[model samples]
Target: MFAVTILGNNSAIPTLDRHPTAQVVTCNEQLLLVDCGEGTQLQITQYRIRRSKLRYIFISHLHGDHYFGLIGLINTLNLMGRTEPLSVYAPPELEQIIQLQLDCSGTILKFELSFVPLLPGYSGLILEDKDLRVSCFPTQHRISCFGFSIEMQKRKRKLIPEQAKAYEIPAAYFSKLQEGADYQRKDGSIIKNDWVTLSPGKAKRYVYCADTIYDVNLLPWLKDADMMYHETTYLHDLEDRAAERYHSTTVQAASLAAAAGVKKLLIGHFSSKYTELQPFLDESRPVFANTDIAEEGVSYIV
Candidate 1:
C-alpha cells in the first residue's frame, strides 16, 4: 500500500484547472503530506484522504507555492479536534515563519506539532518508522531546498506453507518462522527458518526530486528507485527559460530519469502558461518511455 497521490501539480500560480504543488504519500496506514501549497486542505478533502492517519509533513522548500497553505491546514486540523502529534520537517526558517503566524493570530493547536529543521546542504536519513524510511538530499533550487527519498521496508520473511507443512511445524509457530526465528520440534530438533521461509523482498523506493534545475549530482540519490517524481516545469523549447528560473524542462527531466534508471517517472509542477499537457508527454516519452504526467488526484503506486 505504498503510493503517492498528487494533490496540486501546477507551479507558482493556481490555474482554473490546476492548483499548486502538493502530494500525499501513503505508507501502509500512515500518510505523509509533501509540500502543502495553497488550497491543499481543500484538495485533501476533495481526494478523501484520511486526515487522521497523517502523521508527518515534509516541505521541500520555502517557496510560497510549496508551503503557503501550511498555517491554514494546521488551523483546520486544530479546528477539527485532531489530537495526534504531527511532525513537520523543513528548513530552519520555516519554524519561525509558522510560529509567527500562529502567535500573531492567537491560534493554539490542540495537537502536538514538532518541527525538524533541515540545515543547508544536509543530506542523510531523516526518518525511520516501522513501515517506511525517509532520507533527504539537497537540490539545486533558488533557495535552500531538498528532495526526499522514501523507502518502503518489507520486514517479514515470506513463508513457504508447503515446506512448513512438510517439516511438521505447527501453524502456531508460522508467525515466528516469518520473523526469521528457528522452530524447535517436539523431539528438540531445530528447523532452520530459511528452510521454510524466504527472505523479505527488496525495499521499494520513491524519490521526490523537489524543485531542482537539471543537475546530474542527484544521480546517486535517484539511481534505481522504483518510482521518481521530478518537476518538468516547461516544454523542451523552454530549456533556456527553465535554466534561468532554476527549473527543469520536460526533456531534461526525462533524460535524468532515463540516466538514473528509475522504474517509472512522474513529472509535474507545470508552469501556469501550459494549457494542454499533451505536448509535455509528446516531448518526454521519446526520451524516456516510462514517464507519466503527475495529474492531480491520481495515486501512483511505488
Candidate 2:
C-alpha cells in the first residue's frame, strides 16, 4: 500500500509533544524518508519502520528543522551494516556538509552513498521507480527550498473476466488480459485487447509542501493531489509573522489545498509557542473539509 507516516510534525524548536519536520513515504516494499529532522531515527524505531527497507532520503532544504538528523541517520545506517546503495536528494551543499562530517569522524560508509543535487530554482522529475515517481519544485522560503510530489502509478489494466469468457477466451489466458494483450481463440480470430480490458485507474499522489510561504504558483504541481502536506507554522491570528518568516498559516494552507481540489490536506510545522493544535484544525476545516493535523507517530494512507 502507498502511504505516508508523520515522524516529526512540529516547526522550529523541538518539544516533548512536537518535533521538527520529518515523514516516511511508503511505496510498496520501499520506504522513503521525506525529511530527516532531529530524533527522526528514534521515531523510526518507535514506529516500527524497517530501516533496511529505506532506499531514498529527501531533504527539502538545509534548515536544521528539516535535516539536522540526516548525518546521524546516515551514520546509523552504516553502523547497522546496511550494504544497499542509498541515494539522497537534496540541495547540492548537503552532500559536501555530510561528507565533511563523515570525513572528520574518520568513518567509512559500508554502502554506496549517492547524492542527486536539487538545484536552486530548477524543478522537474527527480526519481522514477517501478511503483512510484517523485519530483521536486521550488518553495518560497528564506533559503533555497523545495517540495516533493510522490505519485503511485497504476500499472495493471483492469481485467474483465466475463467479457473475456464471452469471447471464448480461455481462463488460462486471463493474465494476458490484465496485461492488455490480445487473445487468440480456437476459431483463429484475434480478440481486440480493448474489448476485454479497461485502462488502469488514475494514480494516487502525495504532495509535501516542505516549508513555504503562501504561494499560489504551486498550484500546477499540486493539482488534484490525493493528499497534500502544507506547513502551517502559525494560527490565522499570526498570519503576519508567518508571512515574514516565509511560513504559512492554517488558513493559507487550507485555501491552497481547496483551490487545487486536493483530496485531503495535512497541516503541520506548528510553532513551538503553541501547545494546543485544535485551533489549526478549526481554522482549516472550514476552508477545506478534509483537513487534518499532521500528527506525529500517525500514518495517513494516500
Candidate 3:
C-alpha cells in the first residue's frame, strides 16, 4: 500500500487547470504530505485523501510554491478538530515563517505541532516509523532544497506453515517465527529461523526530487528506486531558459532517470507557459522509456 498521489503538479504559478507542487505519500494507513503548495488542503479533499491520517509534512525549500499552503492547511486541521500531533520537516527558516503567520492570525492549534529543521546540505535518514523510512538529500536549486527518499520497510519474514508444523513448532510460536526467531524444541533441538521462514523481500523505494537543476551527484539517491518523481519544468527546447531559472527540462530529467536506473520516472512541476502536457512526454519518453507524467490526483504505486 505504499504509493504517492500527485496533488498539484504544476510549477510556481497556479493556472486555471493546474496548481503548484504537492503530493501525498501513503505508507499503509499513514500519510505523509510532501510540499504543501497553495490550495493543497482543497486538493487533498478533492482527491478524497484521508487528511486525518496525515502524520508528517516535508517541505523542500522556502519557495512559496512549495510551502505556501502550510499555514492554511494547519489552520484547517485545527478548525476540523484534529487531535493527532503533526511533525514538519523543512529548512530552519520555515519555523519562523509559519510561527509568524500563526501569531498574526492569533490561531492556537488544537494539536501538537513539531518542527525538525533540515539544515543546509544535510543528508541521511530523517524519519523511521514501523512502516516507512525516509531520508533527505540536498538538490541543486536556487534555494537550499532537498529531495526525499522513502523506503517502505518489510519487517516480517514469510513463515512456512507446513515447515513449522513438520518441525513440531507450536502454533502459538508462529508469530515469533515470522519475526525471524529460531525455535527450541522440548528435546532442546534448535530449528534455525531459515528452516521455517524466508527473509523479507527487498524494500520498495520512492524518491522525490524536488525542484533541481540537472545534477549527477543525485545518482546515489536515485539509483534503483522503484519509482521517482523529478521535476521537468520546461521542454527540451527551453534548456537555456530552464538553466537560467535553475530548473530542469524534460530531456534533462529523463536522461538522469535513465542514467540512475530507476524502475520508473514521474516528471512534473511543469511551467505555466505550457498549456498542453503532451510535448513533455513526447520529449522525455525517448530518453527514458518508463517515464510518466505526474498527473494530479493519480496515485502511482511504489
Candidate 4:
C-alpha cells in the first residue's frame, strides 16, 4: 500500500476537468494528505479513500490552490465524529489562518487537531516514525514553499528460510529471526543472526516538489529517489513565462528528474490553459525515459 494517489494536479485555477494541488501518500495502513486545495474533500470521496485512515496533512504553502480546502476537510472530519487526533505540518502562517476560520465559526473540533509549523527557508528532517521518515527542503517559488521527501522504512530484515531450517531453527522463531534476533539451539550453541538474515533492501523514497521554479538546488534531496513529482506548469516553449512566474516548465521538471537519476518522474501541477496532458509525457520522456503524467485518481506505487 505504499504509493501516492493524485487527487488534484492543476495550478492556481480550478477547471471543470482539473482541480488544484492535492495528493495522498499512502504508507502501509497510514494515509497522509499532502495538500488540501479546493474540492479536496469531494475528491477524497470520489476516489473512495477511507477518511478514517487519514492521520496526517501536509500543506506545502499557504497558497489558496494549495490549502484553501483545509478548513473544510478539518470540519468534515469533525462532523463525521473522528475522535482520533490529526496532525498538520505546514508553513507557520497556516496555523493562524486555520484558527481564525474555526474561531469565527465558533466550531470546536471533536478531535484533537495539532499543527506543526514549518519555518520559512527551513530544511532538514521534520518527522520520523516506526514506518516512515519525512524531511522538508526549500524550493524556488513565488512564495515561501517547501518540498517533502518521504521514505518508507523497511524495518524487517531479509530472512533466509532455507538457511534457518538447515540450522535447525524452529518455525516459531522465524519472526524473531526476521527482526535480527539470534537463535540459541538446545545444546546452548548460538546461531548468529547474520547467518540466516541479510540487511533489508534500500528504502523506497518519494519526493514531492511542491510549486517551484526551475532550480537545481533540489537535486541533493531528489537524487536516486524511487519516484519524484515535479510541477510542470507550462510547455517547453513557455520557458520564459514559467521563469517569470516562478513556476517550472515541462523541460525543466524532466531535466531535473534526469539529473537526479530518479527511478521514475511524475510531472503534474499543470497550468489551466493546457487541456491536453499527453504532451507533458511526450516532452518529458525524451529527457527522462521513465516520466509519466500525474493524472488525478491514479495511484503511483512507490
Among these predicted structures, which one has the highest lDDT? Answer: 1
Stretches off by above 4 angstroms in model 3 are 168-172, 186-188
Q: For residues 76-188, what per-residue lDDT tens digits would candidate 3 score against the true structure?
A: 99999999999999999999998998999998888999999999999999999999999999999999999999999998999989999999999999999888899999989
Assess each prediction's global lDDT (C-alpha) against the native. 0.96, 0.94, 0.95, 0.93
Question: What's each prediction's TM-score?
Answer: 0.98, 0.96, 0.96, 0.98
Query: Which model is ahead, 1 or 3, in terms of TM-score?
Result: 1
Expressed as tens digits, the lDDT of each residue in 1-302 for candidate 1 is 99999999999989988999999999999999999999999999999999899999999999999999998999999999999999999999999999999999998889999999999999999999999999999999999999999999898899999999999998998999999999988899999999999999999999999999999999999999999999999999999999999999999999999999999999999999999999999999999999999999999999
RMSD (Å) of each candidate, 1 decimal:
0.9, 1.3, 1.5, 0.8
RMSD of 2: 1.3
TM-score for candidate 4, please give it.
0.98
- Regions of model 2 farther than 4 Å from truth: 168-172
Arrange candidates, best lDDT first: 1, 3, 2, 4
Candidate achieving higher lDDT, 1 or 2: 1
Q: By TM-score, is 2 or 4 better?
A: 4
Of 3 and 4, the candidate ahead on TM-score is 4
